[model samples]
Target: MANQREELDGSLSVDDPILSLRNASVTFDEGNSFVLNDVSLDLGRGEILGIVGESGSGKSMLAEAMLDAIPDPGVLQGEIIYRPDSDTDIDILELNKNELRSMRWEQISMVFQGAMSSFNPTMKVGAHFRETIQAHDADVKAGMSRAREALADVYLDPERVLDSYPHELSGGMQQRALIALSIVLEPDILVMDEPTAALDLLMQRSILLLLEDLKEKYDLTMVFITHDLPLVAALADRMAIMYAFDLVEAGPTDEIIDHAAHPYTRALLNSTPNLDAPLEEMRPIAGQSPAPINVPSGCSYHPRCPLADEQCRSVDPHFHDTGEAHGTACFHWQQARDDIELNYKASVSANPNTPARGDD
Candidate 1:
């Protein structure tokens, strides 16, 4: 089945995406060790693509690689094609420093994780906004007006938030400020790296609502990166699952949630608690994710997967399409699905209070 965005929005198409990552890889100085493996995905115009994974799964690195901001000592390779308009296509990795800087906030912007650390404590919020706008060559007077408008759009009191220092605002306020800052330039696409990870449940909920509002108000194409599966599932039109450094699975949000083909994706689902189901049915994924430097050979997930076999342990598996819009890089996806069904039935039967699994 096609994605929700495709069905509802005639302008968005997967075939000619707004952003396309092709064989994109990020590596540090270590030989043969990658921060992000050859990961490729697409972001359609005005669609939210959720990239979810455990920490150290290269979610942030992938976001950095997308914008040619992979930090010093890290090298990025392959293509990151960006389409500002139907006729214009630019490879982000190939752009010169000046060209890249010109494109960063004006076309593609990011809201980094950890709102507290993102701001300079000594500087007033307005000062940070001024710097961002000034860097992009906007005049000081006009910049402040734009900043005020942006803050107001996020539901913050523009004057109060602009006058206060970063430490003066609560965690939630700081996050909202960050969102305001990222969209101040009115970028076509937004890359958010765990923007709500530090907040409480209430704050997270508010941020999610704000994000939805912003997406529609700005007609923004978004890449939302986080470790929270349910949170992403709630907001995203499509989902991508990353493990160790590779993109293990990606498909429509409902499809991946209902019929996850990869064992790692299933493990994550099992680990997450569902309010409608019995708490006893929830199970944590066994074993820790391997460190990037020492990632396991063959399939990186083979070490922790219950469905692993000799082939899975000895050879890397490429993406195998399981449905029209779904793909998994698992040699035993069919077996994994069968096992997941059996386990799910066993758990629900053991606890009659558990809700039946919903359709994808």
Candidate 2:
């Protein structure tokens, strides 16, 4: 894997960001509530940027907003800038319908969540590939060749897969086919939402390996959205943690794993099961994630945060630089590392042997 953060000590961010989201917000009910709020991040070319959080954290919404694919009545606010190269800057939200049609699939393609449902059941896999390519006005004959090439790239035999319906393929095969289809157009950026969420552990690992291969083979930049932290940690060059529609923390994968600056980020890391660590060390986060419609005031994560105080209850926090290109949105980010460790030590000392409730 490439160490994009190696130069972080001297730079605040990537020298060239292929995609940028600036103060992006999405609302399904006008401005009454937001599914995504004030999200801002950058994706460097040829790098995988993983967006991870629990359900309802706006990871999918952020992905959809990037491609202007938000469903009916969902309004997107702020800028989604796509810089294909140094010479061009395209405001995604400003693009007309025709322009958008031309841009999608060719420049930015999405492998949506739920591979089983993402395809047309009645259509053969080849038909799906054919239609997608045809819609973009590419020659059907050439497109079929590209489709076959894509299938082969993902290790799927085009001969069997192209003729089969979505239901005909196994869960893992369906996912591999979906990935193949996403790349058939050879887009510069690929936005994949939970591509491996439905697969078994072994299959999931296989799919991730395939993705890593694809990333290198195609020189693809990817925005991977998922709820699994450990899974993303293995694949993403950098990780961004979102909470209640807000981006809580983002940094290089190594930096975030080694020294997470936010309480929520630490909680997530601790929550994951580690075979190398004692079972007692797996501490589940204390409370439920806040509901989107009823997001808490001030810091959205404060209600569940151990370090929250009066200020955290009344004033929202912005991203504070935590060095090495890491930025966390927490008023007590400076104190998080020690405080969380102290709390964990106290909890383990008190229980000693009892595993966390869900471990059973």
Candidate 3:
């Protein structure tokens, strides 16, 4: 396999998105269930696009769809176009097996959850790194020297990790090793699914910082998949919120965190724990997510949305842009916008002992 020669041209405006998903939908069980429903999003070059949602919200499924790793039984529809630094865009979903094989580690790479499982327990860490790099670039130097450098990039002691098996490394070390492996081929896009989920708070922060550094160093466009709103807020340039297999909101991270337009988005922001705030202040969204097989009609979120009304129960909301680079799928976005402050106030009122709204 050969790495595509399309390097970052640095010509496209920073405002121009490098990746786009248009009206994307994924279905399973012979179309009886829509795992992803008309979801669309964009990721600009060198920007981190964070995808946040609760468990069972189809966040991982969407990531798998992007990587074309959806199982055989599932069906995917819609376009995922990737533009490599202003060269012609390629439809990721349309690529055949051979094309996908070539593109996976060279053009785009994935850092799956459970980094330990991603590596072979029987193989030395160095061997795995060498194989991964060689798979994309056979001409790459296949020696201990290069492998050591790869380990060092993630702050791991090169010699110690090089000789250790996956089972021998600590959890944090394994995670960092996997991250190094993901970037070994230097793909233009790195799709990380909960890259720091398995680590402790300090380790998680460190990993995130490393990701930020690497992104700047290599100009990598990243897709950070997670349910943690605070982490997303800290690292991402933009964010897309998913619920019931559909994209409910997306926009610049700062805007999404401070001025979310979607009810679900607002709920997520409210649910996040504010360290400075009292325990009573952190109220997670109520009710379990609807099953994909039996999703609610009109809007999947209507059943759980506090702001849901007759219109929300009867009419499916379109993913409409709110004219500030923020888009939300809600029939009552305008009304919700007007009511956000009141809703937050009510939440705060319910827990008077909590810290002030802007305390953080």
Candidate 4:
């Protein structure tokens, strides 16, 4: 949906978005390994798209592909299209080094995980802020002023952070400082890879709240990548679930969180510790995630799936439409959900204490 609100920086958004990944796949080791397979996703002009999955689930690779940061033996296939406006379009995969460099901070900026370690220790914090401005050709006074403003936005003391080195700041402060740096240039889209991964629960909540405020303050379209489902549900407009390197399901955040169709996604939601649910009934998924290098044939999730049958093992599943702009890569979503609902009913009947699965 096109945003009706005023744009951040008073800029205009194209009514139609061409910013999307269409069948984008990434492989390494001379194409011997596929880390991401046939992932197709489109970003709305001003919405947060959350990608969530377990560790080693290719979530990081997906972000790298968006930034065209893959190198050497890594090969990318299909298209990463960027259309800033209706008048122009660029295939991000085809850009050369110089061309890509110009677009990096100018159009898209990324906030890496463990933001504390991303800084250069040799330089004073202020110098790093100044250097970022220098790269964009802004003058010293303006950059410093903006740097202070950015820090203030993240609730950090600008003067202290500017003078101190990266090591002087607490982990959470450093992360907020990093986030400040990311948005200083006012990029259209901000891709955050596990931005709150290292923080404690309270800090995570605070940082996430800050992110939500910043998104509105800047009118930012964000790509929030993490394994934290509830976190994403709190911030993202829409979300996608990845499994075995494939984009398994995606929809509006509430829909995906409350009415999930994919088995893996259901398993994930069930596994989450819900305060409303009886603690004794909450269960984790049955098996460990598969090694990507040795991903199973047909459906990689089949081996661990409780509902897997001969058909699930032998035939690859294609995305089945569940709602408008929502789909799940599962052959039995309809039947599965029905059976699960029946089971939940039976359980509640038997115990009178079972909690219903009320999630995506």
In terms of lDDT, model 2 sits at: 0.82
Task: Give the clashing pairs for model 4.
Answer: 256-360, 257-360, 258-359, 258-360, 259-359, 259-360, 260-360
lDDT of 1 by residue, 73-190 (tens): 8888878999987788999888999899989988999999999999999999999999998898977897788889888888789999999998889888899999999988889999
Give all candidates' CA lDDT scores: 0.81, 0.82, 0.75, 0.76
TM-score against truth, every candidate: 0.90, 0.90, 0.87, 0.88
Show where candidate 4 strays beyond 4 Å. Answer: 1-15, 341-360
lDDT per residue as tens, model 4, 187-264: 788899999899776677677778877888887888999987776677787788988887778887777776778888
lDDT of 4: 0.76
Give the clashing pairs for model 3. Answer: none
TM-score of model 3 (CA atoms): 0.87
**Which candidate order results from sorting by lDDT in descending order?**
2, 1, 4, 3
RMSD of each: 6.9, 7.2, 7.6, 8.2
> Candidate 2, which segments miss by more than 4 Å at Cα?
1-13, 342-360
lDDT of 1 at 216: 93
Sort order, TM-score high to low: 2, 1, 4, 3
Provide the lDDT at 209 for model 2: 73
